[model samples]
Target chain A: MSRPRLTFLESSLPYAVNAARLIVMDRGMFVADFFLATTVPFLMQFLIWSYLYQGSSISRSFGVLSLSQTLFYYAFSIAFGRLNNGYDVVSNLSLNVREGTLEPHLLRPVPYPLQKLADFMGGGVVYSVPIILVLAVFVFIPPVALNSFFWPGWVLLVVVSQILCFTLSWTVAMMSLWLVRTDFALSLLTTSAAFFGGELLPPYLWPEWLRPLMSYNPFRFMISAPAQAIVTMDGGFVMTALAWTSFYAIAFGCLSAFLWRQGMKRYRGAGG
Target chain B: MKKYLLFFRLGLAVELAYPVDFIGYVFTTLFVHLTRFLFLNGVFDLTSTLEGWTRRDVMVAFIFSVLLSSVVDSFTPSIRTFVRYAHTGRLEPYLVQPLDARWVMIARWIRPGSLFIFAIIAPIAMLTLSNLNVHPTLLQAVGGLFALVIGAIVNIAVMATWSLTTLVSKRDLPTEFIFRQVMRLNQLPPSLFGYKALTALVIFLPIVLTSTVPAMVVARGEYFLLAPMLGAAVLVMILFMISFRMTMRVFDGSGG
Candidate 1:
């Protein structure tokens, strides 16, 4: 009898599960990681913004209606920031390239990028739990919840943003094939995204001239756009976010493919 | 002391070996600081003060925070190296040497790349001070320098204590991640935190001493804080020494 062949989902599911397993392997570390990275930063932001908005006059100056809304924006932004983070993608891919471990990955039945994508999605599955809890608080809690009519649009923005974030990271990580190190590049990418994506400062607060750049950046779609949609309760903004994110996803996806091919050729030339 | 100086020279040489990487790091540091400067400018544009801290006062705090952070970054061992050494028994060689093993672990992996950030910080600090039209008295300047040295001692002691976790834990925790996040709290004026939170941080972690206290002393002439800051630094160093002794008892050749 012929051996049974596995479907794409069947083949990829194990990789995803393994990645998720690795993330939650140490329960103590997992909790500490979440607390330190998310809770502490969010609390700091809350303190700073609360101090800033102590005066009703200054709250108006921030263009944010109330302290609650500003706090909600930061809370969701930090959660989404964790969801869309790509530091591991860059670090892992660079390590593989540097150590010639790409050979085994290339020879896998599934494509290399697909394997990485599965792994990324798998890890994201573990991370998405906190995000869901955060959203639940905002949705079910009477006091903080905004009865926004743009829930469906916000959902679409979230889906598209994940793909865009992954593609952008993959494209950047491909630089490791040529460069000796990608840590500097990774730092630059993350810092720029945090600034432009409205995690550090909201788009509403940006100067008029810088508004265009903020809107057009890839990171804006991944982080701020989804947070902004819910915070501002703007239906039109959600559509814009979906469109921009999808466009960048496709562009970066293609760029990543091209780079992978070029990198493979170089790898072969160098006996990788 | 001479051997530690040699280690520093070795680190500088190693960093210079990869000029492109060094330059990239410098650029990234510049970009991060520039964005922070712009963010502060945007906040100040809307309001002149944050918790009674004027734009100039906050800028002073930010500059000192960055400077202290750079000092920590320059000398601290990369967490990856620490973990690798622990896992592979590479640290065993250093333990048997005549030098202090704890200092060897740190001195061997110094990243001089962070020092290049000072080049970017100095120019920005000068321009910001000029723009803010703030001048510090000579006494305040001296106090600020003294506070900075004490702060560095506190910060390093805290980190060194945290680094001992690798000897006890089976899996390495993201200690560096926690450290960086905690360090970021330095950027804000310590006064922004509540009395309880500020007291806890000062007594236990002393992170605020690294940036906020010095900034307050220099920018606002808050000389009263200097004595407490020194006390905190001394407390932290003692705690670190006790922890180091306890951890060393359990540490084996490889990760325990």
Candidate 2:
């Protein structure tokens, strides 16, 4: 919820309120359709997966813990969905390079990445409230678990995982300076989540060969680790997932910064 | 027909303008199909006849989805999107001329994108069924082809109804996703008897006839002789045609 330290008139309160009013008047159907199609199907798929997991052999541990995992998925999936307020750094950079907007942001006090990050986080916070409320209900409803579920290690790991995802995406967006588009590049990062981030289907259902590598994959940190913290109530693997997650975060974050600096040198544009 | 061809060419031209889009679209769709095939692959690997069906027989069932998509492209290109034009007041322009609306609408879909999909669907299904095509009696292939066409017509009608609903309701709830589910139920080659009422409903509710019965006719599966099979298909088509015309009347008359 941290605001970028700039006093932009557009982000000012009066303008913001006006924007919200205009949005409600114009694009309400977009919200209704998104809820019905995307969110409903997401929760439905979660229900079916939880049912199947309980039916399988791991039902003993999974049955007791799976509800929280489902809730975790619902929360994080919504979090991820809300966090991406259609401002993929890569797409934005590609468009900026095309339209010559990057120079203005660069001239500003805030770093471009920081500016984008804050904007996305602010928007994500706005979206997260309703989504978090709906998802949290899964925790308290019938057969809910309320107790001291201490898994600080896992929570920290999820933070690291989100950082790593941000770095990788930012890096790709910066790469747009060098290339016209990064369709394959963006797909490579995002589709892994589709499979492993436990969104489309949980990582547990992956073929036997692919199960163990979930720890190495940066995705599980975003999706599986936080849920694992509550459901399993075991922080044993949380440290490991976090260690790798943070490692990738630092590694990719630096790489992206380096690439951005270097890519800027290659930037030839209609001078602003 | 010529008028429809022009509209279709417009769609085709739009597609051609974006060369890179095809690669991503085709790859993602093909990957989804592959994953679905893999899930079934695991099931078949574990069990036989899927409660009394052969592996190749199951493959035949899966092929129906690709075939249905291909056959229905002429009906609703890109799955109910043509109906989008109809309701958007765009179709008014098409209606203004002495155009065969159906031909112009369907023609918009004749392009490279679906051809890629056709390529993906045919190879795997054909490989599995080709192992078992045993020179069926001429009546049988004809019946299979006939049923397949009927299934496509029904899909178009149902999807047209879906598209028209947007005009009245003013919503877009992943109409293509609905088509995907329909494809899911129909494309899978497994039979669903003895499961429950819902599964039974899949058979005659016209989803299964799109793929299952046609595959059966191709494989000469046991249901080919049954009167209920063909009768159900013909009845579904009649209803679909009626529904389609009614929707057209509502939209065309309503000026929507």
User: TM-score for all predictions?
Assistant: 0.92, 0.62
Which pairs clash in model 2? A90-A173, B4-B104, B8-B107, B8-B108, B49-B53, B61-B189, B62-B189
Worst 10 residues of 2 chain B by lDDT: B186-195
Candidate 2 ranges with C-alpha deviation above 4 Å: A1-138, A141-193, A196-208, A212-215, A218-231, A238-272, B7-18, B43-57, B69-111, B120-124, B131-147, B154-160, B163-173, B177-256
Q: Which stretches of candidate 1 lie over 4 Å from their true place?
A: A56-61, A143-152, A268-272, B77-79, B87-90, B123-127, B252-256
Best by DockQ: 1
Candidate 2 per-residue C-alpha lDDT over A121-231 given as tens digits, one digit per residue, 9 for 90 to 100: 434334444445644675566455444434456545544655666776787677567654444445444445544555544455456786676445666665555555545
- Candidate 1 residue pairs in clash (backbone atoms < 3 Å): none
lDDT per residue for candidate 2 within B61-113, as digits (tens), equals: 56666666655643445434455555445556655667555554445455545
What's the C-alpha lDDT at position B90 in model 1? 64
Q: What's model 1's lDDT at A260?
A: 88
**DockQ for each numbered candidate:** 0.62, 0.14
Error of 2 at B126 (Å): 1.7
